[model samples]
Target: MSMVEVQPGGASGMTMPAAPKRRTLPGWAIFVIGVVGVVGVLATTSYLTGEAALTSSSTMQNTVTLGMPILLAGLGGIWAERSGMINIGLEGMMILGTWGAAWGGLHGGPWVAVLSGAVFGALGGVLHAIATVTFGVNHIVSGVAINLLGAGIAKYLSTLIFAPLSSNPRDSPPIERFDTFSAQPLADWLGELEQDQRAVISDVAGLLRGLVTRVSPMLLITILLVVGTYLLLWHTRFGLRLRSCGENPVAAESLGVNVYLHKYVAVIVSGALAGIGGAALVLGSSPSIYSEGQTANRGFIGLAAMIFGNWRPGGTLAGAGLFGYADGLRLSAGPQTVHALLYAAVIAAGLVVIWQLWRRKWTTATLAAVGAVAVYALYYASDELPREFLPYTPHIITLVVLALAAQRLRPPAADGLPYRRGEGD
Candidate 1:
């Protein structure tokens, strides 16, 4: 008998039923799983080897310090892009903010310094809005111009104000450090450890002390800002209209929403956020002096983090935290620590491949296997991370992650498109 069965009183051949839909995991779920798995692997390794260097408090502190600026900048990027304007002058704005904060701190206090940076950053945003919105300049071109302007203006002011105070015009006078409070009893308790267990206890204590004491107000402010950004972008009426402009300005305008006004506001707020990021750097991180290049491409990194997080405040925080952790490793780890991490990553990748293969996910299994092999190859090639490679680790991670996730990432439809008044869709 033939395998095909004929339908009674119908066609000569019968069709097969459709296959069931595959139950794919949500992106956020997958991200959380990955995070948990990585943490588990690191924890396991630490416990087995009795090496807590990877999980030290100093590393955690560094992560927070480095992640703040990136997180702020990412939030700024999210705002600008969500309002139909692409503000790539964040770096320049941050530079101005650094200088502004320095000047303000010298004259007033730390809090005033933050306000001054925000004002300067808002000025940069105003310039961007005038170019892109009022004059119909290309967004990218306007951003580049603003960057040049910010750099030139900062340099000029530095020469005028800082030259007499410091030997180098590029360096400003040291400002009073931010106020820091510590948990004295906890710190003391952690300090009272045996010599054999000192490293681990101290690392743990450092983390507790960092949390309980010596904390800056800027850190709390940054946390509040992240939460506020989330609320403003998702729950507010203004946010809905601003997002509508990014999604489809023509539609928004037809619905009585002023696209131009919202875009201007968005871009301006973006600049203010970037400026605050700069202030956070100086007040929370440095607090000593303003130096040229202190922003150090953190604005660009923030942009990358925004993309990595798909332009959501929560996601951006996760991305920034990840990058910050990587940077902390680069800053604190010696050769042995690096080697251990590399091996751990390779093992994790291999285990993932095995799990995927077991689950019959052929494509994922293959990719994981390839990643494991590549990482192992890298491990074999470099016994120790070269000191010179430290600075590029974050950038390299940004590039690789973006490359892998680009196809799955989506931006607002009208993000980079120009909209003019009375222009028909």
Candidate 2:
């Protein structure tokens, strides 16, 4: 027997090897981890409240239904930011598209209506591109103008096409937001779940299957778009040059990058995305073209999601999901009452005072102020206990969530600022 290599360290004095050193995570990695944690919390909350299991299918359907548009729209923002432009008129674009889509889908032939919406939206995007890129108008200002025009046009169209309630004018019945994945195969899986035999695992799986869905057609399109954006931003040589132009046009011009052309392409892409988002809502969701104030600021909420996502495609997706779910809260939880109102008032006040004192650096103060004002406003605005306000509680909560995202999100170094070539962050 070969002598075993028993060194000085015998069994009793054996020294263990040192643990491997941990690699430090990059900032973006940490951000992703944070997002996962948040999702876990929501998933757990849904499971515990029985809401996760009960509303799984509907919630999943509803989220994909709402999120597809927003996600697509956010990609547009990503394009603009990547190229050092901004498109604020997405809400307006959506409004215009909605009217077009709704009129066509509800009243006209299906294909004709959908095409009408897409074509009209493409035109709107072109106009935005021209104003921003060709005219060198301020990005924010141009977007605002486009948004205004879109909102006005959409409202006018709604009134013209949709009959008034007094005139027995029925606009349309909206599409179903909730759908079941209970195909024959899935039904067998769900049947076992419905029996409640395995309380824990069954409920968890039921909730997962029910409450989450693959992005439908619209979201699928967005996925393609994100891939496109990634390729455009990081892979292609032209994309590298285009990004250079946005970050430093003067320097890019020196290097022979076509600054003007790239900017134009970016702004137009943004507009088109916004229009698609608008179409998703009007054509895909609402019964008829709604006349009210252009869907109560979906554009702004989209802005919030962009901000919350911290200017990343993946992050934006999470932000959109969060806002969509938040918007669903009131719908999922039920309407407000005096009990809710009174309790909300006290809590809001307490929060406001506490936030003023606590110096947690994450824009908590702003949230506190907004929360207090919102509580008071919501309470007084409601005359009935359960009658929903326009666009309802879900919409409002979503808006809040969006704002939080923007407040917390840290934009890339060159995100909003017009690029000055050769400078470093």
Clashes of each: 4, 8
- Model 2 residue runs over 4 Å out of place are 1-36, 46-55, 103-115, 159-184, 187-204, 211-216, 286-294, 332-425
**166: Cα error in model 1, Å:** 1.8
Candidate 2, 1-425: lDDT as tens digits: 22333346345544555556778887568767765545444444444434443234445456666766677677777777777776787777766666666666565544444455556666677887777666667768877898889877765665565655324233433422312233456655764674563544554454455433333445455577767876777789977876775566676777777777787777666766666676666544544344455456766667666766666677677767765654544344444321242333435455555756676635666656676777657656654355535245545555555654454555544444554323332
TM-scores for every predicted model: 0.86, 0.68
Candidate topping lDDT? 1
Worst 10 residues of 2 by lDDT: 172-181
Structure candidate 1, residue pairs in collision: 181-213, 181-214, 182-213, 182-214
Tens digits of per-residue lDDT, candidate 1, 231-318, equal 8888999999999999999988999999889999999999999998888888765546778888888989999999988888877888
Assess the local accuracy of residue 38 in candidate 2 as a C-alpha lDDT between 0 and 100: 50
